[model samples]
Target: MKRIIAKQEHCMGCGLCEVGCAVQHSKSKDPIKAYNHEYPKPISRIRLELNKPVSFAIQCRHCENAPCVVACLTGAMTRDEETGFVKHNPEKCMGCWTCIMVCPYGAIKADVSGKIVAKCDACTELSVPVCVASCPNGALECKEVTS
Candidate 1:
């Protein structure tokens, strides 16, 4: 399965991935409209892991031995064998923080409302993830990784 990989050294901290991701998830799917929307603004599945000199976009690793899936009591978190992507079902989620606590990379995060957990789904619904597509520096790439 293909996963988003980052070239940390090439990252310029431009943050276009965040913008694109949010817009893609928003109601209108328009940058301007999503930014200025009154309610339920879009949120990003991608996050820039910044630390002065080293910066990279971080998202779900979709681990082969996913701790998130093991920790989730409600069975909302699952690993798809065919796609090798860890899937999260918000409706089945009980807003439990088990997944967050066990994720080594701290990829999973709670929303502002705290009603559901969010993480990179690899944009399975689309051909390419917004973050990878919006990267101006070509720092983000989707490739298959061996467990």
Candidate 2:
């Protein structure tokens, strides 16, 4: 399966990934309009963290035995068999932060309404994640990883 891999050495932390992510998920598909709405708040499933010598974006790993899936009591989080992507259903979510707490990478984020959790789904509906497409520094990418 393909996963997004980050090279910290090549990262510039421009935050373009966040913008792309918001647009991709937005109903308007417009960054400005998307930012003004309630659904997508330009939430970057990938977060750029910088600490002097180290700087990189953190996102979901979509683990085969995902801890978030196990932590979700409402079955809101599940793995897609076809794509190997961990998916979230807001309708089934109960506003619990169990997945967020259990995720070691701190990738999951709360929706704008704060009623559900949100995270990278590997852009299963699109050819690629908006973050990967919007990255100007070539820091974020979708690549296959072998177990």
Candidate 3:
């Protein structure tokens, strides 16, 4: 399967990925409008670890044995067999936050206003996720992996 990988050596702590993610997820998909008009606002699915000597962006690992999947009672989190991407269905979500508690990577986030938990779905709707495209450095890349 192809997945997004982080090359920490190349990361310079630039936050363009966050901006790009917010804009892409925004209702208007516009930088200006997203910052000014979007209600409930958009958050970057990718989060950066700023610890000294090593800073890299992290997102959902989509684990083979996903604890989040097991923890979800509302059937909102499910993995797609064809694409190997774990996706969230907001409609089915009851916002119980059970998934958030079990995710070991701390990848899940609460979208209180949206009434759904958020995690990286790898931007399945796009050819390349906004975070990967907007990265100023080559720290982030999408490559095939053998698992």
Candidate 4:
């Protein structure tokens, strides 16, 4: 399956990925409006992790044995049979935070309203995620990882 890989050395900490993510998930499909409303207040699904030697965006791996999917009490998180992408269903989510606790990467985040968990879905509707599209530094790239 194809997944997003970050080139830490190229990251500029511009936070375009977060903005793109929020916009992609928002009803408005507008970055400015999405940030004002549906944006995850403090935490983002994809985050820029800074350290001495590295600073890069992190997101769901869509693991084969995804712990988040197994941890979800209401079956809110599921893996796509064809794409192997981890997808979340907001209506089924009970705001239990089980997925958040189980995700090893800490990629899962609560929605802006704190009503549901959110994570990368690879922008299944688009050829690539808005994050990759909006990244000015070429720091983020989505490519298929072959077995």
Candidate 5:
């Protein structure tokens, strides 16, 4: 499986990763519009974990046996066999937050206004995820791993 690995030692916690993710997922894909003009405000699938002296980025682990996939009551979450990525379908989601409760990493986030959830999709459409690409310090890396 291909996964994002975070090197906490190199992370500066500048939050550019969040900006990149929000812009990439925005309707206009514009950083300005994403932050200042978007009504709902695009959310970043990646989050930075910061402590006074340490920091790192985090997102969905895309578990080999994802609990979110199994706990989704409406079948909104599923793992793609070929890509080894966990996917979420908002249309099928009931907004019950079953998946949220089951996610061990607490990666899934609730979009209360939309009655949906959001998580990392690995930015599969692009060569690399915006979060990883935006890491100025090269703290985030994508690599293949055997599950």
Candidate 6:
């Protein structure tokens, strides 16, 4: 499976990854409009964690045995057998937050209304995820790894 890995030492905490993710997921797919014009605001699948001198970007790991998938009572969380990526079905989600509680990486997030969970889909629509491509300091990389 291809996964995004972060090198915290190289991260500068610029938050461009979050911006790119929001734009990519936005209806307008524009940075300004995604943040300023989009209703409920576009949510970034990737999150930046900062501790002064220490900072890093985080998103779903797409785990081989994703607990979120198991914990989801409504089956809204699922693992893509072919791609080894975890996916969420918002239409089926019950806003139960069971996935959020079970996610080991603390990667899942609630949408603006807190009605459903959100996490990285690895931007499967694009060749490369926006978060990795937008990393200014080479802090994020996409690599093939054994699942």
Clashing residue pairs in candidate 2 are none
Tens-digit lDDT string for candidate 4 (12-131): 888888877877777777766766765454334788888746788888989889999998898889999788898999989989998899899988988777888778878888987878
How many clashing pairs in candidate 5? Answer: 0
Instruction: Name model 3 segments beyond 4 Å from true.
Output: 112-114
Cα deviation of 34 in candidate 3 (Å)? 0.6
- Deviation of model 5 at 13, angstroms: 0.7
Candidate 6's residue-wise lDDT over 58-103, tens digit each? 9998988889999999988999998899999989998988888888
What's the lDDT for all of these models? Answer: 0.88, 0.82, 0.85, 0.83, 0.90, 0.90
Candidate 1: residue 132 Cα off by (Å):
0.4
* Model 5 stretches astray by more than 4 angstroms: none
Candidate 1 lDDT, tens digit per residue, 84-125? 999999889999788999999988888646788888888888
Q: Number of clashing residue pairs in every model? A: 0, 0, 0, 1, 0, 0
Candidate 4 global TM-score = 0.88
Q: Tell me the TM-score of model 5.
A: 0.96
How would you encode candidate 3's per-residue C-alpha lDDT over 1-147 as one tens digit per residue? 879998999888887887888788778999989878887788877788888778988889888878988889988999888778888998899998999899998888887275788888798788987788898888999878986
Ranking by lDDT: 6, 5, 1, 3, 4, 2
> 66-142, model 2: which lDDT tens digit per residue?
99999999999999877788999988999889999999999998976788888987887778777777888888878
lDDT of 5: 0.90
Give the range of the ten consecutive residues with the poorest summed lDDT in model 2. Answer: 37-46
* Alpha carbon lDDT at 7, candidate 5: 92
Instruction: Give the worst 10-residue stretch by lDDT in candidate 3.
Output: 110-119
Span of 10 residues, lowest total lDDT, candidate 4: 35-44
Model 1, which residues run further than 4 Å from truth? Answer: none
Q: What does candidate 5's lDDT look like per residue over 1-147, in tens digits?
A: 788999999999999998998889888899998789988999888889999579999999999999999999888999999989999998898799888899999899986256889889899999988899999999999998887
